[model samples]
Target: MSFASHHNASEKGEFDKPSRKKPMFPVNDRLRAYLKHHGREVKLPVAYRDLQRFTYSVPLKDKDGKDSLWETVVYDLKEWEFIREGLVKIYAILKTEGDLTFTKHLDVARIDYCAFGNSQPFRIRIVNKFNDNYDHYYIKIADASRVYGLELEHILSPNRITFLTHQQTLVEEHIPGIPGDIFIKTYLQDKETNRIRLAKEFVKFNERCFVRLLGDMRSYNFVVDITPDIEDFQYRIRAIDFDQQSYEGRKNLYLPQFFKENYPLVALTLEYLNKDSIEQYQTEERTMMAFRLASARYRMKELLDIMGKDNISTPEKIGQLSKELSDYHLKNPGLLRCHSMGQLVKQHLKVCLRKNLLLIPRLQSRFED
Candidate 1:
């Protein structure tokens, strides 16, 4: 399954510039109420703003001596003590539903800040005093689009996310997996790798992103969760960054396989899967998403209601996406009625899943004959 035939492996240039710099959309009252109803709202002792008071910082490196793009921040002694305690409490809330009994044995091992992202998140490492076990969590400024992305991932995707939001701070449990870029660089070329399985997973992952209108799934923005099975291994690609969820104007931005950094996986798909198989996987993904939508119908409707009224993107971007979708699905007039990204996504799900569901019975009948 060598992909040497796919010579154009540098498609990253096509996506050189996304539509625009994403403005941080505020969490309005309606969205806040939805979060509260869903139990995603909580009171945190420390906010994202409080973590910015670090007195000094030193660059952090990986085991191989490469700069990790993170800095280990240090605070004044008095401020350190207070922030450390608050961090422990925050971890408790994230991991144990605000149970304070476990705080005594936990210590804040380190606080690292990432200066690269839009959120500038602080990564907190919590270590157990008795056994020295450690885990990581993140604190970032709460953006409405990110929150919506997290909620959609929680409800629609197979992965379950644990996060809590306060006024301006968001605490999230660290999703554990090997980053996609690192995996592709190190493991994709290995002889024993399951190319078919990996390619299948990537197809489904691509479909999931497009169906939900989650944008900007560059190689680094996602991770590959590899689980060893009895006979082989299973790989699931999950998006770790959600900053571009439903915000981009270009329709292809929502599809990860279009990104040049992901060309290797795209090449693998071309080598391992046929056109029919790819469409089958995409339909399978849409069917599962439709089922999730059915189960969470009320909550999904409420969330979309709020999102429809919110201004998460510019009017021009919304108009462009709506028109693109309308033209893409020329047979379905529902797309032309969409006035916002949220509405467009809702209609997309309805039209795609309905078509797939209808095709199933006809295909079954053909097989029976």
Candidate 2:
């Protein structure tokens, strides 16, 4: 399980031949070795907890090559920030040979400072390191910055603190938002109007996310603010945690199913896929028609930008959405075996409107005389 061994040997257990093989990026291994060699140089306490057991940190250097207290902490997702008092943090998966996925880094860290935004909430500050290991993998801070911009624009970025890179560590701004479940039970259901407002926002949000290609959305990753504003006494919905976002490619629009149990709208969306490949656009537009049921304009472009795509051509969007819907059903028979996604969507709304009591009867009535 040593880094050197893994890097030197192929998966088949034979040593890689230089003539036919390319030297893999020495990112993780180099950092580990560097940290092992120079732990004392940066005055990193030897007895401290192994926050990143497999990770390594080295002192950052300036143009003049002088060691600075600042250093990048190279570690795996297995060991990011774990404990947060009230802030959310962002991190990148320093992918070497595959598509990079973004995620939140949850670790116990020393808080530096905080700020308050009336619209969003709390913002916390944290230290930043150079993250040279990430640089070695070509996962530059610029990519992270772009992704951050996308999240903010889409309103899918965590309301947490902003993450900034210093010489050796990352400084982050903290964000504060109620957990999804709590927000649902406490705020969403507090009043009929609140629930309706949330549902409207939810539908708009999903449609927007799908058309724009910001897959990997699910419940609990977001929160709703039911607390009425000082002037209007109305509720609001805000999305958070936009780490896993991409536009050029997508497994499916409903990729967030891993987190969500099942829903008719999502099932219908899946059913529209053609061959389990990228979703077709028309199918997505159709699914959106069912999802929105009433709204005509869905703001597809805005969402696409947040998803890092400049435009979703009418033809391309229709094509991808259709393909995705067709393929999704083939991949998930359970979704297709049951009622059509359209029917289920209708039932869900009825259930919501009837206060979750008439759901079964309504579903039975669809088939019964």
Candidate 3:
């Protein structure tokens, strides 16, 4: 199907789910250098390929005994010992800067592999032998698109991202939150749940994703982090999956409000937030993201330069997105000239956050190198 048709459907208040599988883009030399310069490249004791030695697997079930779309993988005895010891060390590297003094008391509790996505990550559960407490981390193949998404999330979003790349392996710390699908199913109508606050957060999240050109934020792709407030409650929606970053051509793909999976959240937004209030939250988020851009302008420039020269998407998608974005920002000539997803993102940032950039005093266009 053509992207124009997809855009038309999106305009008619419908959404088409992104492709079932997005081909993995390898981490090129330039991105590898960027990761190295930014301390995101680390040699780990275990790699993604090593963990594929699982001998057998059992379907993993949730607390309600429903299929969790994951499998508990078992390995040979010797291989298990090797992976357990290595994974414990990896956990330390991710959480405690490679500290091993607590290693003797820690053990790999289980290894669960999910074959559902492009990365097909192995979820590692690490437990402290003494306390019976466990923590989780992930190991996956390092794809360039995901790396760009992670780097952008670290720089632009309010949250801090911690991960490392080693050759074809990627390691990430667990992000704790209720999955958006589960949150909506279980918490949307709860008596104590603050609908207004959540609706406000959804507005901000929508702005964040659109401004940065991040895509595929269906309900399950993101999470809800709730915190206690003195008088009420606060909500923060965070994107958990980065597989679709900068890959789609349709502009609506980057906006969470258009996805059918997010219709409930959209209903909350429309029900609780007036048009002006929604605009206020969008501007507020863009202003904060602009501040973040200023703070990390140098690093963002480096990444954008590398990304502009990378081939993370097809030529057709690139051309379609360029035309769509150019149409969206007719006043900004740069969008018309964007030849790659990275360039579109760079210009889109300027178009969306120009007001906040002006407030930063001499911060505009400093990203040009």
Deviation (Å) of 176 in candidate 3: 0.4
Q: Which parts of model 1 have CA positions greater than 4 angstroms off? A: 1-13, 356-369
Candidate that scores best on TM-score: 3
Deviation of model 1 at 165, angstroms: 0.3
Model 2 misplaced regions, further than 4 Å: 1-163, 166-172, 227-233, 247-369
- Arranged by lDDT with the best first, the candidates are 3, 1, 2
Candidate 1 positional error at 320, Å: 1.2
lDDT of 3 by residue, 1-369 (tens): 112333355458667677677899999999998899988998899999999999999999999999999999999998987888889999989988898988999998889999998889999999999999998999999999999999999999999999998999999989899999999999999999999999899989988998998999999989999999998899999998998899998877888877878878887877788878888888899889989999888888899999988988888888888788778776567787888888888888878888788888767445343
* Residue 298 displacement (Å), model 3: 0.7
Candidate 2 lDDT tens digits, 195-267:
3334334444454444333444545545555556654344333445433333212234333332332132233
Summarize candidate 1's per-residue lDDT along 218-294 as a digit string, tens digits: 89999999999978999999999988888987777787877778888988999899878888888788888867766
TM-score of every candidate: 0.92, 0.33, 0.95
Superposed by TM-score, candidate 3 places the C-alpha of residue 116 at a distance from the truth, in angstroms, of 0.5
- Which 10 consecutive residues of model 1 have the lowest summed lDDT? 1-10
Q: Which stretches of candidate 3 lie over 4 Å from their true place?
A: 1-13, 364-369
Give the 10-residue window scoring lowest on summed lDDT in candidate 3. 1-10
Tell me, what's the RMSD of every candidate? 4.6, 20.7, 3.1
Between prediction 2 and prediction 3, the one with superior lDDT is 3
lDDT of 3: 0.88
